[model samples]
Target: MKKIIGVDLGGTTTKFAILNEAGEIEQKWSISTDIEREGINIVPNIIDSINQQLSQSGLSSTDVLGIGMGSPGSVDIDKGTVIGAYNLNWKTLQQVKEQIEAGTSIPFYIDNDANVAALGEQWKGAGEGNANVVFITLGTGVGGGVVAEGKLVHGAGTAGEIGHMNVDPNGYECTCGNVGCLETVASATGVVHLAQDYAEGYAGDSELKGLIDQKQEITAKIVFDQAKKRDPLAKKVVDKFSFYLGLACGNIANILSPNAIVIGGGVSAAGDVLVDGVREYFEKYAFPPVKTSTEIKLAQLGNDAGVIGAGSLVKMSR
Candidate 1:
C-alpha cells in the first residue's frame, strides 16, 4: 500500500498529510513554519518531519510514491527553486530539490500554494475530477489557479493569479501595485473595506451601519451575516463584492471555458450567501455558452485543500 506525501507550506504553519493511492488522506499533521535565518529552516524542518513520520509509521521512501509540496512564491518547477517570498523572509531559495530529495531519498515536486490548492479541489473536492477547473481563493487577499484538461497550467510560473486581475483603473490600490484588482474588492479585507466605504455618509437604518458607527470590528463574515439577516447596508456591500467576484469569474470562464469555477478560502465560509450572490452576477456577465456550461461551486476541502492538492501533484505526475 504505497502512499503519497503532501506538504502545504505556509507563512505561519505547514501542513503535512499522508494519502493512500486512492486519494484518501490517512494521517495528517503540522509544524510551525520557521522563518528564522532566511527560511533556511523550512526545508530542513520538512525533511526531518517527514523522515520521522515515516519512520514512526514503519514507512520509508520505498513505501511512498513521492512528496509534493505547495509553497508561496514564484516556484520554478523545472529548477526546483523558490524566488522571493518576503512574507516567509525568503528572498530566494535555491537547491530545494537537492536538500529535500537528498534528505529523504524520495522524488519531490513543488508548485505555488494557490495552484496546488486548485489541484487538490479538482482531485477530491467540488471539482470532482473535472477536466477543466478554475479555483479562486478569497482570503485576506485573492488567489487563483487554472486546471485545463486535467492538467495544471503553469505558464511562466504565475499564470493563475486571479487576484491581481485588474477590475478598476481608478479603484483602490492593491498591494500588487495595481489599482482596483479583483482582490481589492473581493477578498475578505476587500469586503470589509467596501463596507466601510459604503457606510460613510449613509442615512440608512441598518445593523451594519450601527456596527460601523460604534467602531466595531466588522469582518467579511459579519457583513455576509447581516446580509442574510436582511440588513440593507450589508446587502449593498455584499452585492458589490459579489458583482466584482462574479465578473471576474465570468471573464475567466469566457476565456478558459472550464467545467467549473470553484470558490474557496476563509471568505468562502459565508457559504450559500456568498455563492448565491456571486452566481446571480456571474450568470449575467458570462458568455451565453459559458453561463450555461460552467458551473459555479464552493470548495469542500477547506484547510486540507493545500496538502491534498500537493499530494495530488505526486499522484498526477505519475
Candidate 2:
C-alpha cells in the first residue's frame, strides 16, 4: 500500500496526514509550527516526525511514495521553490526540500496553502468531480484559490489572490496596502470591526456588548453568537458582512465562471447565517447566468484539506 505524506504548514500549527493513492486519509497528526525560532529547522523535524509515525506501523521511509506540502507564500511549482512567505518568514522551499531529502529519498511537492485547499476540495471534498471550482477562505483575512480546466490556476504567482481584489474604493484600508480590498469588509477582522462600528450608539443593551468582558475585545464569533440569539446589532453586522462577501463571490463568479464556489475557514463556522447571507447577496448581484449556473457550497474537508491537497499534488505532478 503506497502512501503519501501531506503536510499543511501554517503560522500557528502544522497538520500532517498519510493519504493513500486512492485519496483516503489513513493516518493524521499535528504539531505547532514554531517556525519563527529557526525557520530552516522545520524540514528535518517534519521528516523525523513522519518517520516516527510510520515506525509505529512497522513501515519505513520506502513505504512512503512522496511528500506534499502546502505553505503560505508564492511558490514556483515548476521549480519546487517557494519564493518567500511573508507569514512563514522563509525565503526558499528548495533548502527545506533539500534538508528533508537529505534524510529521506522520497520526492516532495509544495504549493501555497490556499491553492492546496482548493485542490483538496476539487479532488476529494465539496467540489469533487467538478473540473472548475473556486475556494474562498474567510478567516482573520480572506484567502482564495481558483481551479479551472481541471487544474489549479497558477498565473505566475499572481493567481488565487482574490482577497486583495478591491471591492470598495472608499472603504477601510487593507493590510495588503490597498484601500477597501474585499478582505477589509469580509474577513473575521472585518466582521468584528463592522460589529464594533455598528455597536457605537447601541453599546448599552447590545447582546454582543454584554457577552464580552471588554468592549474592545469583541470578536466576530461573539457577534455571530449574538446574531444566533437574535441581537439586532449582531444581525446588522452579519448582514453587512455577508453582503460584501457575496459581492466578492459574485464578482469572482462573473469573471471566472467556475462550476462551483467553495467557502471555508474559521468564519465559516457561523454556518447558515454566514452562508445564507452570502447566497442572498450573490443572487442579487451576480449576472443572470452566473447567478443561476454556479453553485456555492461549504468546504467539507476542513483542516485536512491542505495536507491532502498537497500530498495529492505529488501524484498529479508525477
Candidate 3:
C-alpha cells in the first residue's frame, strides 16, 4: 500500500508521521524546530528526519505518494510558499514546498496549521463524513478553520481566521495588535488573564486568590479546577470565558452556518466542562436556525489532528 508523510510544524517543535491512505499512523515522532537564521534550517531538518525514518522502516521514497505539511501563518498554497509565520520568526515568505520537494524528490502540499487540523477532523474525527464544519483550537492562542459546502475555504489564502474576530470592543489587545478579539478572552492566555483580573479585586476566599497571593502562575486548568469546586471567583471567570467563547461561536454560526464546530488544542482537555459552558452561551446568542442546526463537540483526533489532516491532503488530491 502506498504511504504518505505528514508534517505538523510549530514554533517549538515539528511533528512528523508516516501514514497510509486510510489515515492510520504507521510511525510518528517529533524534533525541536531550529528557528535560527530566519528558520532557514527548518526544511533541511524536516528532510533529514523523513529520510531517517524511511531508513529505519526500510522504506524508500518511491513507496510514498507525497508529503503534506501544516504550518503557522498565511500560506500561498497555489505558489507552495509560506507568506509569513511570525511565531517561527519567519518574517518573510519562505519557499517551503520547493525546498522539501527538492530534498526528497517527492511532491509536497501545505496549508495553515489550523486549517489542516480542521481537515483532519473532517476526514476521520468529530467531523467524519461531514463536508461543512468549523474547527477551533484553544491553545496558548486561538486558531480556526472552516470548510463550507464540501470545500476548504481558502478565501485568498487567509480564510478561517476565527481567532481574530472582534468579540470585545473594549477588551484586551491581542498579540495580533487587535483589541477585544475572541482569542483575547477565550484562549488559554485569555482564561488566565481573566482569572488574574478577578483574583486581584476578589476580597472573598478562593483558591484562585490563594494562587495569586502565593505568586504562583495561574493557568486555565487551575481556574477550571476551582470552578468545578464551586469557587465563586473561578466560577465567575469561567462563566465569562464561556460567554465570550459562545458569542464567538454564535457569530461564526451566523456567518458560515457550518454543520458542526469541533473544538481542539490543549485547553480543550478540560472536556465537558469547557464544551458545556460554551454550548450554554452558544445556544443563547446564535441565530434561531443556527442554534438548532450546528452541533458543537470536542475534537476526537487530539494531537494527531495535524498529521492525519496533512496525510489526508494527499488522499484529497486524488
Candidate 4:
C-alpha cells in the first residue's frame, strides 16, 4: 500500500500520521515536543520516530510516496526553513526541510501550520474542495489561512495573519506586542479576557462575575456555557467577541471574496451560538456582494485537520 507521512509539529506535542490517498489515517501517534535547547533535538527526534515507525510497519523510504508537515511560525517553503516560532524554540531560521529530507532521504513538503489546516478543510473538511476559502482558528491565539485560486497564499511568508488585524487601537495588549489585535479579544483567552473585564462592578447577579470575585479560574468554556443559559454577563462577552471577529471576517471577505470562511479550533466547539453570533455581525459589516456570496461555516475535521492538511501538501505536489 502506498503511504504518505504527515506531521503536525506543535508546541506541546508533535502528531504524526500515515495517510492513504483517500485521506484516511492508517495509523497515528504523537510525542511530547522536545523543549531541550530551544528544539535543537526536535528534528532528530522526528526523524528517529519516522524510521522506527517505518521499520515496524515493514516499510522503507522507497515504499512511501512523500512526507509533508504543518509547522508553527512562518515557513520559507522553498528553503524549508522555519522563522520566529518561539514556542517551538525555533527562534532563528532552521533548514527544516533540508534536515528532514536528509535524515529520511524522502521527498518532503511543508507550509505554515494554519495554511495547511486551511488546505485540509478546503480539500476534505468543511470547505468541500472550494477553490477559494479562508480558515480561521480560535485557539489560545488566533491563526488564519487564506486560499485563493486553489492555492495557499503565503505572501512574503505572512499573508493571512488575520489574528493580528487591528481591531482595537485601545484594546488589550497581545503577545505579538500589539494593542487591540483581533486575538486580544477573539481567541479563547480573548473570551476569558472579556469575561473578566465584564465581571467588575456589574451588579446583576452574574455567575461569571462571581467566579472572578472569588479569584477562580474562568475559561472560555464556562463563559460559553453561561451564555447558553442566557447569563447576561456571559452574553455580553460573547456578543462583543463575536463583533470583532465578525468584523474582521467581513473585512477579509471584501478583499478575497472566498467561497467560505470556516471557523475552527477549540472555541468553535461552542457550535451554533458562536457561528450565529458571528454571522449576525458578518452580515452587518460585509460588502453586499460578499454578504450574499460567502458562507460562514464550522470546521469538520477537528484535530485531524492538521495532519490531513499536512498530507495534502505532498498530495497536491504529486
Each model's lDDT comes to 0.92, 0.83, 0.90, 0.91
Give the per-residue lDDT digits (tens) of candidate 3, residues 111-135: 8899999999998899998889999
Clashing pairs in 3: none
Clashes of each: 0, 0, 0, 0
**Model 2 stretches astray by more than 4 angstroms:** 60-62, 83-94, 201-205, 209-216
- Error of model 4, residue 141, in angstroms: 1.2
Q: What lDDT tens digits, residue by residue, belong to model 4 across residues 1-318?
A: 689999999999999999998778899999999967988988999999998999999999988788999998778888888989889988878888898999998999999899999988998899976899999999998999998998888887688789999888899998988899999998899999888888886789888888889999988989999999998999999999999999998999999999999999999999999999999999999999999899999999998899999988988887
lDDT of 2 by residue, 1-318 (tens): 799899998877789998998778988899876576447666667888887888887777788888998977777765667757766667654465666666777788888888999999888988998988999998887898899988789887678887888878888988978798878888888888787677766655676855443645877788888888988888888888888888888998998888899999998988888889899999988899999888888999988899889887887777
Give candidate 4 misplaced runs (Cα > 4 Å): none
Worst 10 residues of 1 by lDDT: 89-98
Task: Enumerate residue pairs that collide in model 4.
Answer: none
C-alpha RMSD between model 4 and the true structure: 1.8
Write model 1 residue lDDT over 210-251, tens digit each, in one string.
999999999999999999999999999999998889889899
Winning model by TM-score: 1
Q: Cα deviation of 317 in candidate 4 (Å)?
A: 2.8
